[model samples]
Target: MPSDGFRGLVYGDWHFLEETTSKSKDSHVSSNYAYSMGIALRGAHYKVYPELKYDSVKPMLFQKHAAMSINLRNTQPMMLQNVQMKAVITKQGVFSQKRIFSVNNSKIAPNSIVTLPVQWQFDELKPGKYKVQVQVKGENDWNKLPMTWKFIKNIKVDKKAADNINDKIMRKPINKWFYISMATGGLMLISLVELLKLLLTGSK
Candidate 1:
């Protein structure tokens, strides 16, 4: 969460390759925002989270908020009356709800910073590669600025620590005998305490 009001919403996940580019290139070229592109070299799995929510229990499970932002200026910027943003998470191109933002630039300067929200949830998601696409609809055309990313399984959220312990118990019978022995010892210890209390109280 950014106090200044910039966050990276989970736009889903996408697979993409990485390459270096020069700073002098144009925005439309693959090298223009080369820094924003390329993240799919690790393997075929990555998790994408739209704007991340702060959770104390599983802080690392969610994606970090977007520190990177865009600065726009309207030089007769077509009165960008409507600004719609959306996030897509798959290669098949399934999209989330379109968040339409209304901005009246006529009253304010063109350099004002605006925050965009991106969040998503999947009913049943397995470990795999996902494409994250951020689309912004402006005055004339739709800015389908695509970025590739990865999605990995969140083991902590998906599996509980107690469940892991139970699994360990089930894996081998040796732990079961140990547990029985410990329980027996605990009972004997309790009985010994009671006997000592009685003896101290003169058989009361």
Candidate 2:
């Protein structure tokens, strides 16, 4: 039996050889015994996949905040416990940011699927291409077997367009007020000019 509570192979054999000179001696025989024990094996398999969503029309364009959904499935027959989830964001293969989330001492039954959602903000990120990677690790209560999963996604950032959208949302009312003020000032100036012309003609 292995440390993972699995048994692989157990073998035993016995062999005996008879002596030729039985008349000279009372009886003589040779015997041999063999035994082999194999190491114990651990069994736990997991399937991990990632899904990404953005507010922009283009899936590749990541603006504002992006939602990362991670799907985990237990493909083995054993239950997995103490699952830990981690996510990392990179810019052109360079390290950018990372986040860690855990499932405590929970157990995921066999053939069961779980979805985890993570939010990433791009407000502070500069305009460029980025890579998002998600990782999941699980261990049994006995701590004998460990399972892991990793996934990656590519995205492009348009800081200029994001800034424009933000500016429009923030200053929409202010722009409307400015336009109204300009139209009113123009009308008042035109009326003053007409009054001044009438006064000049009267004086002449």
In terms of TM-score, the best-performing candidate is: 2
Residue lDDT tens for model 1, 29-64: 545222234221211222222122111121111132
lDDT for each residue of candidate 2 in 13-129, tens digit (9 for 90 to 100): 344445443343554654444454533233442222222222222222223344334556654445556767665555564646553334555555544566554444443334567
RMSD of each: 20.2, 26.3
- Evaluate all candidate structures by whole-model CA lDDT and list the values in order: 0.32, 0.51
Model 2 scores a C-alpha lDDT of 0.51
Q: Residue 81 of candidate 1: its Cα lDDT? A: 27
